[model samples]
Target: MSQQRHELLPTETHDELARESFVQALKSHIATRVSPGVREIYDHRVRDRWVSEHGAEPADRHEVREALSADTYYRLWSSVRRSSQHLLWSSVGDAVTRQADDLAARARVADAGLGTLRLDPDLEIPWYNAEVDIHAMPGGYRGEYMAGDVSVGAVYDRGVYVYAMGQMGALNDDYGHSICQNLLAASYPEFTPRRILDMGCTVGNSTLPYVDAFPDAEVHGIDLGAPVVRYAHARAESLGRAVHFSQQNAECTDFPDGHFDLIVSHIVLHEMSPAALRRTLAECRRLLAAGGLMVHADFAGYAGVDPVTQAMIDWDTYNNHEPFWGPMRDMDLVADAVSAGFDDGAVSIETVLTGRVLQTGKQQRAGQLTLLVGQA
Candidate 1:
């Protein structure tokens, strides 16, 4: 007799097939666009020029092209992977835009929100402040600024919209939710959260997953970007999820002491300097009730991974304008969490999808570590 099949097998098999097709389509699209002339110019003008002037090592243009193609494929696949459930939810995107416009209008007349802040000169913060053009989006966060004036934010918003289209009906947050949900179910089954906070929740990509995972909890998402928070709130509301989106810095949230049952951040730490990271950790600790858990999902150091994978991961830091990523990877997360007053044993690191306890202190020497989950 044939072996019994798991109930999830059919769906899993279909998903894998869909992912494979999407990857192939992405690869074909990239290959077709990367004409020989374009490749030559990118190689000679960009790669070779940087190598000679900056003393950066030269990577073969063909190899780099192949890598770029692969990266594009993976990014596209990952984007749609998590949103498979809502892939048919067509109306949510429209709802998000409509809600955003309403919220933006409300924020303009109000004394608070992104409309009031003065840009810090020392921070070199790239987003706009006074007018509704956080990051130069027209009507900035308030959507009052004209699109022509806020070109940067407009382009950014367009990119997000385009990506969301590809996501079908999935929540707009990072693919982290599905991955984290599976991981928690398999690895940490003992914890049941009552209240959850997602930090640096730009546009709510990582925040909505917690709501799905812990249906009973009040999910709150905070970010420093006003426009992003407004945009995120609208998106969440459109999806019919009750997520409270607020504009607040992760370094010092205004929440009262020990109010949250779970605190999480995804792909947030690398953007900060060491000092900011410390403050964020302190804030996370302060917000967690006793026995509450804190989990951060971010990249791990390339300390122990195979050499090739490590190099590929490290390349992203410089090539993608993620200047602080390398430094954060080098920093010891365990030590950082311990310093914030969590007991050593109470803090643990694991993979968010696999439920595997990551070998802490083991660096991915060659390849970049994918995801690290730190608990406090």
Candidate 2:
């Protein structure tokens, strides 16, 4: 489903800080319109044409992408959609950059509770991170220009709303908020977590809500981007939430064995290589306390979805700079969880509806989604 039609877009009145110009806003709107139409054309026209000529459907997203890659409509959609993504960043970055120093200063003294920020200069950034701008951002998420800099993180905090066309709600924390409403509230009504970990938490947008959900829990957010974590720390402070932000990789962490009551990630699977994902899961299993839980919410089911839809999703794999999107989504999570030492019978999945989704008046979305869940 299109995030635009489902979730409301940010308006001039709602987010004056973004300062979107008429040209940039128009480009972003055009992109939002193009993204869904690309899928519509694929589902209605191209897939039908392929079936008519071949007598059989394309087996997967790759084949679908290949078949449509040469089509005029598909080419135009890719070009315009890609340009719009850049334009969205430009609109937010232009405004956010001007206040980078001020943001950094605020973040430095922003914590409201017994929270902390930890950075490891000796830590090595993974090759996937050092290799390319994963999301078509000019310098990438981890890029840092100076000490105590929050420019990249500030851009991300606002850029994501622009990218999602404000579908994530006012603060853009609905992705995390969804877990509390769907999985936490519905699945484990009586379970009370003592400690929580948000792995690969970029700006802690998805990390902050667990504090509100379980006020007594010691919440910690981890990622490789020092600047983002710095920004996240300040953000949690500004929101009056207690979250310890740290710079670390999820594949291997410094936490002791069985240290946390809950571990979670939101839409983080498609960002890493399969090996990294596997390693991360294994580490998650190691970090969870006995009787604790681990759950990760990802995108629309990859292998389970129609080929045409899968092809549309693959647009990220090629056009959006998400190199591992295809393999990560296509992975066999049950088997992967088993490989990670999670009990075979205890491993399960759920498609949780995000909170913003509920406000869209489409409560049925709760069942149509999926989340990979495991227990220690």
Candidate 3:
């Protein structure tokens, strides 16, 4: 199913919609039909060859990667997955390009006078973001083609739905909603934040949920992309949610120290390089008020996970242009948080099921997210 489009979303024509639907079905078929075969081939062919040559099962994900790298079936699966990622962007890009000017106009008019949009054209684009198109998106997240280019943001807003195979819910905000409702509310019921900040908030999909979760709290979201923040501000306005959106690097921002009572980020950690991530964590600590909480959530961690599973997760590092994905997973997030100035006892790395599972055909995959949480 397509997302429930708001005023800022590009209007798709019949043929564009059909192409997007086709791409979604292709992705679903690949996930359910083709992906499972990789495991089967590994078990029957790759593992057997490894045991015969090494005299023992593969010791770690590195060995698994070495063995799988030579296998034809694994390569095929990886190629297909990479192709689908490209197709996802291309399909969505068509609609966005056709209506780019109109969409920008709509965003300008859709402002409900509820929130604010702050952009800095001179803000430096970090090397990690400027280096490659993360997740194979054509323009990455910050590409601007025209004067008021919200095209890339629009592509991402819709592409995420098709990429996740519609598991992220109507607004693709399940990660934000799940953490707020299932994790934070249950873990700290009495805590009510006066000021909340979301870092690396691309298009505010995850940012707007905080407004609903804490209606009276001041909500602010910051990203490095002007187009993304612009679209996010308009989207929030159209949805009748008051959310402040700004284009600012998470590593260093204009906000004063200890300005936020609650700081959060959804699926943002892995996108950053180690140095940047370390700085961002320290900045999170610096921005957090006394007794305030900080939470950074992303895909499952690699610790204690089997070599084959690790290999599967690490696939993104090589094929998906996410050079930092594997290393980030292996890092000691709890230790990192402590090093960032949080009390050692107040920080922890934990995994929780979001219960937002998506079923494609006969396959059932777990919806798991890992969190690095700290309290100052």
Question: lDDT: which candidate is best?
Answer: 3
> Looking at candidate 1, what is the lDDT of residue 91?
24
- Candidate 1 residue lDDT tens string, 122-182: 3223232332232222333333233212122222333333333334123334344544555
**Global Cα lDDT for candidate 2:** 0.78
lDDT of each: 0.52, 0.78, 0.88
Judged by whole-model lDDT over C-alpha atoms, candidate 1 comes out at: 0.52
On the 0 to 100 scale, the lDDT of residue 19 in model 2 is 46
lDDT string, candidate 3, 288-354, tens digits: 9999999899976787798997998799999998999998988888888888889989998766677
* Full candidate order by TM-score, most accurate first: 3, 2, 1
Give the per-residue Cα lDDT of candidate 3 at 305.
91
Residue 341's lDDT in candidate 3: 89
- lDDT at position 207, candidate 3: 90
Ranking the candidates on lDDT from highest down gives 3, 2, 1
What C-alpha lDDT does candidate 3 achieve relative to the native structure? 0.88
Kindly indicate the candidate among 2 and 3 with the higher lDDT.
3
